[model samples]
Target: MTVESAILLLPWIALVALDRRALAGDVELSTLIEPIAARPVPGEYRTSIAYYRAVLALRAKDARSARALLDAVPRPLPRKRHAEAFEYLGALLDVVEGATERTLASAAAHEHGPRRASWLAVRAHAQAASGDVESARATLRMLRALRDPQLDLASVARWELPASRLASELMRGEEHPFR
Candidate 1:
């Protein structure tokens, strides 16, 4: 492999190693975020770090803090990271703040992207939260068609799986009467 290819491959290999280790035991979200946030990277990468921290905050049930962090995310995120950030942020808004309509709108706006499945999944949760069962089911049907496995492992291990699973259940007909 060329030097450039080798350089790119190393990050992926490290991420895979981290994923395996995370699966073996509990991985702290803050532990993952702090290091990334401390070093100055490109603005685009910093936006992703901020978004991940927001996801961690939401997972910790701190909606207020999550919103604050999310608000600080720089606009016009790098093209490569934009869709995933939007999907996760929308889901967090739906779950934490109960802003179903806004979340759904945000998710729907990104439907044409590579992260469509993730956006659909978040939209499904938003619809379910809004008591729109039919819409949620339709969104899930779309997601099933795409079959994106990354949806299951999108965020840090401590939060991503549980949050996505909860969102899936909410979409799959479990009535959340409490909003």
Candidate 2:
């Protein structure tokens, strides 16, 4: 990797380590967010910074901040570098905030690709949150049909991890139409 790529990769490496630590319930969200956010001009590490910031905000019950930060992420991010961002953004909108319509809309804005499975998962979660069990099940079926073993770690961490912990707390358990 080039020096620039190496430099950019370091923070995410550290973040993955920290996320693993957090998964073990040994670290605090603030501990993760402070270091990442304090780094110089995070635009170079935009997706990582944004993902962790949104995670921290959600952990702190600061949904507004999380939403703003996630919404600000630019689309068509670098194919290699942006996978986590798109995944996390979808989770934040569909699962964390119970914004299914918004998540589906956002996914629609992007051209279809392998990434669609992750997006569809979020849409499923949104549908589930809205009490549309049938639709949610269908979406999940579509997600499963993708047959892509690739998992978006960021999205899984943002949505499934928290949902496993907090259950009904992440999504409000109400249908929110796409706006």
Candidate 3:
């Protein structure tokens, strides 16, 4: 609403508009880390940066580091981002814990819309990881059954639209413990 605020937000908007994912993997996390850390709490800017950082850690097969970022997205993310934060957090933590009932239940508690789809994908992967093929297949089928055109839109396409991404990742031998 003011010149100073507009100036402050200009860079953040540009940073988001340019597609940070285009940045090369080898660009040195240090270069971009400071900017992401400088964002304030509870907005899309902060959550998105944190999620991207977590994704990078996951890409390196470093769940421990990713966990720290995922965990910081607020325990109850103010309703707007609540489902996503919990979905990623639950799936990651459950996989780390060997997909036990406790973790699955926790993940299930926050499940919503595609968040449920993502959670199921993680659950199925965990089941397969634990040698429960039949269970995994069942869960996978359930996720597939929920498929719809809505997922193609950007509003629902957060991180490759969880369910589809998780399915493809599983098939491609990519280890995305969570979407």
Q: Pick the candidate with the highest lDDT.
A: 1
**Regions of candidate 3 where Cα sits further than 4 Å from its true position:** 1-44, 73-79, 97-99, 110-114, 149-179
C-alpha positional error of residue 30 in candidate 3 after TM-score superposition, expressed in Å: 12
Q: lDDT values of the candidates? A: 0.57, 0.55, 0.52
TM-score of each: 0.62, 0.55, 0.55
lDDT of 2 by residue, 114-152 (tens): 567656655666666666766765555565466656532
Candidate 1 residue lDDT tens string, 18-136: 33333233346356545545554566656656666666666677878878887776665576555455556656566557777777778768789776766776776677667776666
After best superposition, candidate 1 residue 71: deviation in angstroms?
1.2
Q: Write the per-residue lDDT of candidate 3 for residues 1-179, one digit (tens) a residue.
A: 43234325654553343233322232344445455457563465666666667766755557788788888776555555545554655575556556556656655674564457556655665665566656665676566577733221121213332233445544456644442
- Candidate with the larger TM-score of 2 and 3: 3
Candidate 1 error regions (>4 Å): 1-27, 78-80, 152-179
Decoy 3 TM-score against native:
0.55
- In model 3, the worst 10-residue window by lDDT is 149-158
- Model 2 CA deviation exceeding 4 Å by range: 1-30, 39-42, 59-61, 71-91, 94-99, 108-111, 145-147, 152-179
Q: How does model 3 fare in lDDT? A: 0.52
